[model samples]
Every structure is written in C-alpha cells, then in structure tokens.
Target: MPTAAPLAPAATAAARAYLPALTGIRAVAAYMVCLHHFNPFAEGPGLGGFLHNLLLEFHVGVPVFFVLSGFLICLRYYGTEQWTGRWWGRYLRNRVARIYPMFLLLTTLTFAPAWLAHAPDTTRLWLLNVTFLRGFFDAHKYSGIPQGWTLTVEECFYLWAPVAFGLLRRRPRLLWLQPLGLLALGCALVLGLGPLAYEGLFGSFRFMLLYTFFGRAVEFYAGMQLALWYRRGLLRAPRGPRGLYTAAGLGLLLAAVLALVAVRGQYPYGQEAPAGIALNNVALPAGIVLLFAGLLTEATWLRALLASAPLQLLGRSSYVFYLIHFGTIKGWLRDYVTASPAGQFVLLNVLAIGLYYLVEQPLNRLLRAPSAAEPAN
Candidate 1:
C-alpha cells in the first residue's frame, strides 16, 4: 500500500485558518436558492423561458450546500482517532446551536399567520417544522418556510458525520463502498419499497429519497473525496492564465446545468422526474465540484468579486437571509416588491442583515460559548 502524502504548506495553512472564500461561496449558493424560490423572470417565448428554466434549475444550490457541508466537516474532523464523550457533546451542541435557534424562531413565525387563521392541521404542521422532521412526510414537507425541508437533510448529515468519519478512519477502504451503499439504499427505498408500502409511508419514502440526505449522499461523498485529496496535497488551484482555468471550469459547470435542465424538462420545472433525479444525483454535484475547484484554484476576476468584503458579509448573514427571505419578508413585500427583482433582492439582504445582527449572531455566540459550569481549560 502507498503511504499517504503530506499536505503542502499552503494547504496546511488553509486547514488551520478560516476559508473566507468558502463562506462567500455559501452566500452565492443561498442567493441562488433564494432566486429559485422567487422565479423573478416573466413568462414568454425564447429568452424568458430559457432564463426561467435556468433559474428553476438553480435548485442545484441545495446540493452545493450538501457538498460544502461534507467537505468542511471532513476537513475539520476526519482524522480523529478517538471520539470522546466530551467531544461528542461539544459536537452535537455546536451543530444544534448553529441551526436550531433561528430555525425554530423563523418556523414558528412562519406558521403564525396560518395558526391565527386556524388553518386545518396547523398545529401538526408547526410541530413538524419546529422539530425539523418535516422532510420525512410529504404532507408536512412544505408546511413552514417550505425551504426548511433542506434542514432535515442537513440535520441527518450532522448526526451521521462523526459516525461516518470514525468508520472511514478505521477502514479507509470503505470510502469507495460508503457512497455506493447510500445510493443503493436510496434506490431500494424509491423502487423496492415504493410499491410495497402503505400510501402515506410510500409518500414519505418518495419525499425522503428526493429531498433528504440519503438520495443526496453522492454529492456529499464527492466533497469528502475533495477534502481527502486536499489534505494529501493532491488538490490545488490551477496556476495558469487566469481566464484559461476559469473558462474551462465554467464551461464544464454550464454544460452540467444545461444537461440537467434538458433531462428534467421545462414544465413541472422543479418537480423531480425519474430521469431528472438520476441525472441530477450525478451531474449537479459534478458542476458544483467544478465550480468549487475553479473558485479555489484560479486567481480570476470572479474569485476577487466573490471574496470581496460585501459578499463575505452577505455570506455570513446568508443563513438568516435564507430563513426569512421566503417567509416573513417575502410574504409582507410580495405585492410591493415581487414585480421588481432588484428591489426584492435588496430588501431581502437588508432584512437578513438586521436579523443576523439582532438575533442570530448574538444567540449563536452565547450558545457557542463554554457554559459557566464547564471549567475553562
């Protein structure tokens, strides 16, 4: 067996420090998802439909988040030889603190209007959304802030990551098997179980495979593989004419997106077709990987723009932006702002910034701080 190579000095430094570019890219992903939800384009022939199709396919942003999560988590914690109780406690707490507070607040606020109206099953809807289990049941999947479905998948990844890391560390060979196993499980659920299960259970399975972590494991694995390569000094930004690598990466990514749109078709645009899901489970992740590589490797104009301070701030506040954009403010401003895409974008950013500073940031700091009962090491 070949011994693993050491990371280069730059890669070593990157491993230790915060990757601002990654954060900035996250803002881009969040914005893409936001745009997908808004569908700002007017319907028409030729150019309008083309643009609309492109925006619809931006649902690929969710896979971007998944890949980033897998890469970052693996980069941070992959090589740990032991998983202590204290370590696990801290891990779970950090994950919960990072996600649950704002999620719960926003979810409740989102459902408040429905509850006040006494909509049918509003109580049950609130329960599912607040618990982050809405993704499991088709009926509840779009209950509160429809986008919250992605959080269910994220939570599953958070719970399973450490276990996956431990197993991979012990049996590195399983790296090849793990992703395949997940894909197989997803296929089995969608195919073998779909026909046999009760209606509700089958609906749950369909939603789970389409929206939850199991079907998306391949994308996460792609990211994990990237991290592994990065740690071993096998991955680097391309060193060449700035436009050369950037153009190449962009071309590949565009091709993937076009392929996805073509396979998925235009009408029922965002709905998952059999062919579309199968293609997206592979192609979309490939595009994201290419885009990520280009951003990481090339010193291009795009990189500079993405790494700018304003964008970084947007990225930092993106979680809040995502939570509130489609729910609170969108509903409030729908009539006034929906007609103007630029206006909607600007207002959403402003709202996200306010929410981040007022609630999410402070609460995050407080929760992440070591408890008074826990002695400072």
Candidate 2:
C-alpha cells in the first residue's frame, strides 16, 4: 500500500498546544452560567426541583468567568503598549466592538415581548438596558434580561481599565495594586462601612458606584494576579497528580454551589437571612474566585479535561451565549420541549452552541485583524 501522506508539520504543531484546554474551561464556565440562568433544579421558581442541587450549586461559574476575563486581559495586554497608551480611544473602540452589538441586539430582543403585550415599563427598560445603566437605579433592577447586571459591571471595568493601568504604569509591578485597592474598598462598603457613613449609602443608586462595581473587581484582579504569576513562571504548567487536583477543585466547587442553593431556598429573596453569616454576596463570590484559581494553577487531570475541544468551543462562545441565550434561546424552546427543567436546559444549551458558531465565532474575527500601529509592545 502507498505510504500514508505525511502529516503536515503545522498541523502537528497545532495539535501539541494547550490553548484548547483553556477554551474547555471557558465552556465549563458558560455551562454553569447557563444553568444558573435556567434557575433549574432548585427549590424555587422556573426549572427548580429536578436535580438534587447539582445545577443550583454551580452559579459561582459567573464570577469564575469574571476572574478568567481579568486574567486573560492581563495576559493579552501586559506586554502590549496599546493597553498602556496615552488615549483610551483605541481600547474603548475594541471594547465597544466586542460587546455593543450583542448588547444592543439583546436590548432590542427584550422589547419584543413587551411590545406584543404592551408592557407599561417596556420603553423605559429598553432605554436603561441599552444605555448600560440598568443596575444603577432601583427602578430598573429586575427589568430587561435579569442577567444584564453583569454587563453593567463589565462596562464599568472597561471604562476604568485605562485609568487603572495608567495609575500603575510607573511601578509596573504594582499594576495589580489599583484593582485590588478598589476591591478592598468595595468589600468594606458591602460589610456595612457605607451604611455607617451615610445611613443607606450601600444599598442606594449612588452606592453602586461604590459597592457592586468594586465587589466584582476582586474577581477580575484575582485573574490578573494569576496571569502575572503564570508569566513570571511562578505558576508552572500542570504536570503532577492531575487527578487529585481535579477532584478537589471540582468537589469544592460543588459544595459551594449546593450551599448557595440551600441558603437561597431557605431565605427566598432575603440574602441576609442567616443574620451574621454574610452568605450570599460575601461567601459565594469569594469561594468561586478561590476555587477557580486553584483549578487554574494546580496540576490536575481537570486542567487537561478543560483543555478539550468541545468545552473550548463552549468557552469561546460564552459571551455570545450569555448575551443571547437568556430570552432568545429559551424563548425559541417553547414549541419543541416539555416545560420541564431538563428540557429547558437541553434546549438552551443547544441554541447557545448554535448561536456561538453562527454569531460569536464570526464576530470574534475582528479581534484577529492586524492593527495598523505596531503590535502592542
């Protein structure tokens, strides 16, 4: 028989890399976020009461994504001059290109049902959602797609990133300082410092500029720190007892997820029900950031699993799925599936994947176009 055609060197080289594994991590995060949105298999509304807390406990995945984004931004930008440049216009342009189209699309999608039913607050909600001010005011807190709250946080970070990088420019090593300082200030406010100062400051619209924005900054900075560590070779690539690391990281994640679900059910909407525990806001995000860092750093089979192909696809498209799957993906599912938790999840995930391939991948091509200026430095 004729010898098989020799494998292309480039193809072989591509096969040996680890980026796909990182993509798989992205997939896991996206799935967790989807499950959280489904609100499924828990003890409350929507898809709750099916599984025994598996889905309910995994809501920490979003904060994990926040951390990952922070880390990846540092990885992509730390050495690049554009990120550390004089004007923020270019950075703003890139950020807008990445998020605005999908945001505008989702805002419009939220309006369709309202228009159909002539919902009274529809127009105002649309305006708030599109303008990135949805979470700043109490009136619009639960309006539009409920998931848009994270987008509001993301918008602030995008605006603040330049100021952040600028402040840390001279020291260079102190780059992590700015976001970390912001994070600590936020934690203090959430722990009631703001209330002590202004009597209702922490929970007010003005306070979002203080508390919510800073609280999530921790996740981002946690990621940035990891990126710095990895670059400095303080974080070696995984090559040890991968199985044990994977198992522990996953088990911790599961426990955190379950506890949050249990707490939510017992308390309903009152996050402070435990009185002194500070369960909802404090523990959950903290646990998520810790677990994610553990997973990203530790040597484990879990990391390898995260490096897989299918997971990577989900991970890369996470932003797209996040933006579209809420109303559009699930909204399309009404005709085909039973109105049960599992059915809704299956429908949403499938639609999310399709949207990723159809929309997200194509749009991300913009990030790859060569810049006219010298590549960031």
The runs of at least 3 residues in candidate 2 whose Cα sits more than 4 Å from the true structure, single-residue gaps closed, are: 1-18, 37-54, 79-87, 116-118, 171-211, 237-240, 243-248, 258-266, 269-299, 335-343, 366-377
Model 1 Cα lDDT, one tens digit per residue, 1-377: 12224545655555565666678888888988887887878667799888888888777778888888887777765554245767678777777778789898888888788889989988887887788767766656776888888898888888888777767866987886886777677667667656655433325444655787887787888788777877776766666666554577567657766766777755465337667776567766776776777776667788888788998889888988887778665877777667566777788899888888889878877887384122110
TM-score of each: 0.87, 0.72
lDDT of 2 by residue, 279-319 (tens): 43444445554445555566556666666666666666667
Name the candidate that leads on lDDT.
Answer: 1
Per-candidate Cα lDDT values, in order, are 0.73, 0.58
Where is model 2 poorest over a 10-residue stretch in terms of lDDT? Answer: 368-377
Best by TM-score: 1
List pairs with backbone clashes in candidate 1.
237-297
